[model samples]
Target: MGNAAHEEVIASINSQISETNALINAALVAGTPTDKLRKKLATLHGDLKTAQEFEAAGIADEQAKDEAFVLGAGTEIAASTIAAVNAELEALGVVCRIEQGGDRFAEVAHRIAVALRIHEKVREKIGEAAAAVERLETRINECAARRATITAARLDGKSSDREVNEFVALAADIDALNGLLYDARAKLDGIDDSAEKAAVERLRADMQQLVSATLIEAVTVHVAQAEIALLDGIRKLHRTGLKHAPHRGSTPRSHYLMNADLDFFCRTGALR
Candidate 1:
């Protein structure tokens, strides 16, 4: 990219990061509740804000400095959230990687990341969710085992009534932990999906930097389909003979023609 393009992209990211950071600070102050996080998220990005203010151009003076600061803070906050979430996930993933049965879940999570081109850090966090569930389940099992042991000992009346009650209470604790674990696991299932959405948002930001417009079009062409047109052009030239194909002309013209062909070929996925 040219220096201008680079600057544009960097500025856009910085603007968003700053705004996100601001909201993060606000959230930290208010406490990171789900509702507050959702509210912070619905705010517009820098590009969107700028475009929205397009009508202000005719004013005596229009300053974007204040707006920039808010956007920049928010961007930073969002980025930090992504990083923390990912780190938690990564730790969980490594912890639960021992068994092949657990690995299937990891694989499924990984597939979601790949399908969405999610940032690697976020994917790591998504993987950790399952690990957390596994840990919770382990805790529940431990409580159950302890309670069972105590109950069996009670068959001989070796334990006190208070001790039996405590064991029974632990069983209840296990049930509560299971409830939390199941809910956590369900939330984790969507983390990767949000990561996918984040990737798309990243792309949208990039497009805005390139061309500040919200209307987007995705252009994709299979190699076979794209090549068909080129092949058809060549076939037409072959059938029309040398006269219709045009002459090579002078040395300068020939060099220019060859270079253009090379450039087009490179862009058409031939080299790739």
Candidate 2:
């Protein structure tokens, strides 16, 4: 039986013992035979004692289970593939303390696991964002070099229709790179790390400078106006994405509350 069942058994036996003692008292007051009633009370005491023992054993078994779970979770966290997660666990002082098995221990371990999972998810997205940013930077640099070459040719009075068309083509390339940057920034919507966020912002600023310079060197007012419109579009998309993005550092709690992964972890005690 479970601990609660054992407690119920103890309670029932105690009630029986109490009723038998009442009978014995009434018999004494009436000067009647009370030997059988006394024997029944003694039997009830024995039953109560057995029930209490069972309850204690059940509690011990539960404690053992808790201890095992805590130990296993600690091991898993220590060996997590994400170095940042492991470092966070260490900073939180949760390592090597799982032997303290109880509700509190379980709660702390669960919180750690949830945080680790959230961090892993964010890290993966950030990696993707970083790659996207790199691609955008590469394309922007190529466009800038091409613009510089065309501008030099124009200054030398060697400009032709083909050069004008190529210069205008740089606007299309910038538009595409802007789209890539927009996606990268979107991926960072829920990022919690300050350093990572700052790094991305710096990369964005540098890219913007390159783009502005390239557009200013446009050979005609019409082309410059078009490039400015493209830049404005990028700024609009960025502002909209940031405005609608989930609040920073809120991803962990939101994910924990709504994610099926939490249910799976609660059932299996295994990290995905």
Candidate 3:
């Protein structure tokens, strides 16, 4: 299949996935008919079938790629949900630290408000964190493309400008991220457990290495975080092996309630 076929297949499969997820939500929560669940499942099956055919005809080896999409959406959703849980737990911890129980002087509502604000900041940070990972992926892709070696003519493909820009923008604040982590480590230093501090250091080091490719470190980080973009799919489909950084755990699912954000907007680049 040509590039047009590949793009169209991607578009169609993404649309089907989005529509099916919407149907599932409506059935479960919106008082839709009971039979709609089966209809939605059938719709998913059909979309997956079409996606598989497209994979087989156009891409060289697509089983992994196709399954990766399914697995990634699932992973992204599960992981992001977990992250949110962790965030909530942390907020509760903060609340506990502050709510020492006193007269109205304690101002419990004020503490709650502060916690909520921090929660919002953390949410933005998670997006920022995901953005950082996306940038690293772009750099890796650019490096790979620079070294792109096509041994045959018919198999030729190149990176698109838009893809490069989008991926890079997601990771644009790597340096600021490093600064934030460093400050966290400093604030928590000497007061927290040494092991926890050590863990923070390890994370800081890994993130720095991911951003700094020219370093002579003993290890290189593979990108663990990525968006469900077509360029990303193409990268994986083309066998672009990542050696560092897995940011999948940092994804936020709240924005993609019902997984529509993950499927329709993210995959189709309609709301990117």
lDDT (Cα, tens digit) per residue for candidate 1, span 1-272: 32334456556755775777787778779877556544554553545456434434422122343344434543443444334434544563422112222332333333333434335435666777778888898998889888888888888789888887898799789889989998978978767556567665664454334221111111122334456966666555555544443465333333233356667776795752
Clashes of each: 22, 0, 15
Model 3 accuracy (lDDT, Cα): 0.47
Sort by TM-score, best first: 2, 1, 3
Query: Which regions in candidate 2 have their CA more than 4 angstroms from the true location?
Result: 81-272
| Model 3 alpha-carbon drift over 4 Å, by segment | 61-272
Q: What is the lDDT of residue 63 in candidate 1?
A: 31
Alpha-carbon shift of residue 119 in model 3 (angstroms): 51
Best by TM-score: 2
By lDDT, the best candidate is 2
- lDDT preference between candidates 1 and 3, better one: 1
Query: Candidate 2 versus the native: TM-score?
Result: 0.33
lDDT of 1 at 266: 69
Which regions in candidate 1 have their CA more than 4 angstroms from the true location? 1-118, 193-272
| Cα lDDT for residue 138, candidate 3 | 65
Worst 10 residues of 1 by lDDT: 211-220
